[model samples]
Target: MDLATLMSKGLVGPLTAPPAREASFPYGLDKHGLHEIAEAAYGDRAAATGFLLAAAPRPPRRTILLWVTQASTARDMGRVPEAALREATGGKARRLSLVTRHATDALWAVEEAVVSGVVSHVIAEVDSADFTATRRLTLASERHGVPVTLLLPHICEGATAATTRWRVGPQPSAPNRYDPRAPGHARWRVHLERCRAAPALVGQAFDLEWNDETLSLNMVPGMVTGSPAPGEAPPHPGFPNRRTG
Candidate 1:
């Protein structure tokens, strides 16, 4: 066989590009994937967790979701209360919460759950995960067709192999319709630090509102608010003399 003939037969200088990843999970993730949610310097980490809980791919009606968090994190941030969880997910997900003493153990449990295939989703709240550990989790998640998320603190830096990395911060609540002093809907300022699938949206910022009634995350171009002037009223010290006839 001649060199030219071998070349014609496609001995190949570089391999062909792999097929485009199929859409298996919501938000442009393949069947199996790794997503990371990290807090900012003064951002709301619980909001980050709620964002994940509210926005992560919904597996099915009856599938189980795993939540693994470090003991220290549970102490600091406190667990996502049942009311919040219910409000976020519309009481759809059946979550099994587990607390681990160390981050490593929590990570291990995340990997095992991803590989198990029984659980549909896994969310682990650990202090940090190095690139290597995250890479392993990524591989396992991709293989088993399970989606896993790592919720790390603000200090986590450097590179990671996760599908996407988001920095979540709590924004001021939208103005209340009935009461000016009361909070309206939950709002978040989400920064898409990294996105393996949609690199175009990477580094983009999104102002999101979590509508618990609909259990949906809506993207608002700008803040939706109203001035409190229309609802303002001077307090009366003597009697209820505002509007009664």
Candidate 2:
């Protein structure tokens, strides 16, 4: 008998097809499958990358992260500060960095890591990727059940096979609660450009906040006249390493 017939006869537990996409969290960033972040011209690509790293669901223990970047990105944007990464991950996850001269090589490394099953996650920063490249990465991610995030520049245009595409740019942070002059919590003006999971959500823009204290990403209301922006955090500075003399 066919599997459906067997199920009707109670010979097997009820069979159901898997979901086309993973269950998404509040914002689209937590998507378990592949994700892509494309920055606008002169956009703060580093911040978007860092947010993805910080916002990613903490991976299981004993697996490290694979980070691939193009040489130009490294030279122009510079690498993420170790202190910043440590804070973003809550000091639990470790990362392996791989710098490639070409965007293709960087993308290749991302795919290899996704299918290797050695690392828990793969995050790549490249200038651009074509549809074929993204499609391959998506298949590998689904097959391996691993998550991969690609950070691209504004130049990265055209169609793609990624699960979601977010156009991220810096936005004015909320007014500081403690020190009004100081910058408040990290905020971004985000556009959910494309989504295979929730296509209807596309075209809408969201003001997002990265809460470092809780290490969570939240969608807050946009700024309004004469009012503190949403998702403002208490002002604080980086902790010192040693006691003051």
Q: What are the models' TM-scores?
A: 0.80, 0.80
| TM-score of candidate 2 against the unseen true structure | 0.80
Query: Which sections of candidate 2 miss by over 4 Å?
Result: 1-20, 23-28, 60-62, 223-245
Overall lDDT per candidate, in order of appearance:
0.76, 0.75
Candidate 1, 7-44: lDDT as tens digits: 67643223233324532223433245788888876447
Top-lDDT candidate index: 1
CA lDDT, candidate 2, residue 239: 70
Lowest summed lDDT over 10 consecutive residues: which window, candidate 2? Answer: 10-19
